[model samples]
Target: MITSTTGLYLTAFLVGLLGGVHCLSMCGGLVGSLTAGLDPRIRRDPWRMAPYQLLYNLARIAGYATAGALFGGLGALLLQLDAFQIMQRALYALAGVVMILLGLYLGGWWRLIAVVERAGAHLWRRIEPFGRRLLPVRTPLQAAALGYLWAWIPCGLVYSVLITAVSTGHPLDGALVMLAFGAGTLPNLLGIGLLAGAAARIAERVWVRQVAGLLVIGFGVHALWSLFG
Candidate 1:
């Protein structure tokens, strides 16, 4: 039998990979900006760039954990309400809609995702300053902290995962689910953060994000169907 811990680890790894692919578009630019001007020789040295990338991802993962904790707490309380099941189904439905919208946005069918992006603007504003302070980060710890903090930026993807957590019923379980989601994103992100130019070329293709969006939407639909059917 798969223990909860095993499940969490598996979920985290899968989600990290998928999330890494999904984040290619958003993260590519940031990684480039972070590592723009090093010497060609240094840039080519995986030894140097690897640590920076690792730190960046570590920070983002930390952010996901923090958000999971907060949301998990809320989910726990909400579970006490008599209408919890109804609310969960509603959240699942909303997540499906958001995933579809994200798919459209990824496919260039819609550009109005600014509305969703704006929702996290306030949090971003607060965190942006801290990221700036970590500029030219030379250590793994620094990269991790910055990435952890950066993860809180409001995102439709994160929002989708949040809803998934809430629906899990147990607050701790919900949090772990999101953590799994974050872990799923790591492989791609670690690659992109370390090798921005190459990763960007691949990720920037219109078809990739569209397909990822579709997969996410499918997950959302599956959740909803399982709930209501």
Candidate 2:
């Protein structure tokens, strides 16, 4: 079970890493706005901008971990109910299916996940004002706040991973899963000079997304096979 859990963590990380293209597509404007808000002196100097970038991303990941814990606890509660106990395996199965759908979505083969994102839009509308207030960020704290707010944005990719987090049925495990995933995404969102540009270019290619989608699909298949094989 330990090994299996660890494998799930790895898969989560890869999903985040490989999902960079999607992230770029979804949040590219936000990332641009983040940098744009920085003082010109800091923006021009990589050293100065580093701390702001790091803090915001870290805070964003923290938001994900917090959400994971909430969903994980919800799963735990459902399992605790006598009538709902049987739903545990069903949740896992659903998670696997969601991953497969996420792969298809990432590969541009399907877009059903957009409906899930749209469902969250109303909540985002409420939270967006807080993020806007933090804009033109001068302090790391303000940037962090903005990043945390950004985490709640309607994102199908994030919701897909949250499905897997719910299947974990443990708060710590779910938080860990999201932490690993967030770490994997750190490289792309870090917005470093040349590397960020190169990553963006690479992620834009059709083949990269297809390859990533296939690998994610394989993970989902493996998960389902383990459950029923």
Candidate 3:
């Protein structure tokens, strides 16, 4: 049987993959723009551009992993406080509901997800300036740095996944979870950066988005049921 831990990782990756579809819908142009910012020569040569793209994503994933670790650490702290059992239950329940909201956001059903994102904007602004300094990237390090900044860009998808990270209640566990989520998002963001329109088209398929959304909802339901069961 798949360990519950492994299952969580798989789910995180799936969530990332599904989020890619959403990214294509919402951030396709942004992906394209990242490429546009690349050196013209690199942009023109596929072989040359591959490394830069990879570096950018690697950085982004690193950021996600780091964030997960922090969230997990906080969760761990929260779990140790008074009424530990109640706190754990509450945390899991919150995660379940957030997952449902994520599914809705992915399905284009509940746009309210953005409210969470807007809350993160304050943090993003603080980091945005630093990211700007690396713009028009000329080196792998620069690309990676830019990606680290990109990871902080507020999105409901990320926040929803963080809720899962929070439930892990260990820094390492949280990091691993977010790393999985980041990996899931990789295909979409990476592909659009490379294939642009073609990949975006595939991501934009309504059926694909709906299926991913339903799966997310199922995860949430399962989570809640487990709590009550």
Candidate 4:
């Protein structure tokens, strides 16, 4: 029944890992553009560029963790209301459904989740200008700022994971869950910044995406099944 905190962390991480194909499509272009804006010397040398990439991604993950904590707190507040058990069950069910929808979206089998992204479009527009100002990144700070701002970009994948975080019902647990998820995403995004073209090509493969999608779907199915078990 996935009782352990460790199990929850693993699920979050696997979801992030399996969802990399979607990450490639959603953030790959942005990563490529940002990397291109780096100082010529840093952009040319792998060793020099590595630090900027790390800072950028780490800041982005930090943003996710921040959001997760906030949402988790909200979930905890909700559970304090009357019928706490009912509320908890409802939240869990919602998390499972969102995960299933995310899996479908990742597989390209359904586009409904895009609607959720659209809902956040206005907020992203406001956030995007700040990111633009950070461009032509000459320092690690700029890259980090850019990454932090980009974390607010309208993304179904991020939102889906946030739902799972909210189900944790504890701010610290939620933050940790997202931290693990962000760690899972680190490799693919880092690769995109450093090896943009190759990473994009590999992620573009139809079978690779389908397989990842199915695996994620299995996680959701198990989550639902566990409720009755």
Per-candidate local distance difference test? 0.68, 0.78, 0.80, 0.84
Pairs in clash, predicted candidate 2: none
Name the better of 1 and 4 by TM-score: 4
How well is each residue in 1-229 modelled by candidate 4, as lDDT tens digits? 4668898899889988998888889998788877898878888898889998999999999988998899889878877878866766666677677778888987879988889889889999988888888878888998888888888888877887787777778899889988999988998999988875898899888888888888888888888888866
Off by over 4 Å in 4: none
Error of 1 at 3 (Å): 15
- Candidate 2 lDDT, 100-218, residue by residue in tens: 88788878899887887899999999999999898888899998898888888887778767877776778988888888888877887885321446656777789988887887777
TM-score of each: 0.84, 0.91, 0.91, 0.95
Q: After superposition, how far is residue 159 of candidate 4 from its true place, in Å?
A: 1.4
lDDT of 3 by residue, 1-229 (tens): 1127787788788777766776666556545656888888889887888888888888889999999999999989988888766776787788778778878877778877778779999998999899878876778888888888888888877887787787777899999999999888888777877775788777677788888788888877888888886
Sorted by lDDT (best first), the order is: 4, 3, 2, 1
> Model 3's lDDT to the true fold?
0.80
Q: How far is candidate 2 from the true structure (C-alpha RMSD, Å)?
A: 2.1
- Give the C-alpha lDDT of model 1: 0.68
> Model 2 misses residue 112 by how many Å?
1.6
lDDT of 4 at 55: 92
Evaluated with TM-score, which candidate comes out highest? 4
Off by over 4 Å in 3: 1-3
Give the better candidate number (1 or 3) by lDDT.
3
Clashes (backbone N, CA, C under 3 Å), per candidate, total 19, 0, 3, 0
Query: Per-residue lDDT for 1-229 in model 1, tens only?
Result: 1224455446345544544555777766667655654456667888877767776776687678778777777877888999987776786677666766665666667756558878889878988888778776556676676687678776777776676566666767766777787777777777775765687677778787667656655555654565566
Cα-based RMSD of the predictions, in order? 3.4, 2.1, 2.2, 1.3
The lDDT of model 4 is 0.84
What range of 10 consecutive residues in model 1 has the weakest lDDT sum? 1-10
Error of 2 at 218 (Å): 1.6
lDDT value, residue 44 of candidate 3: 87
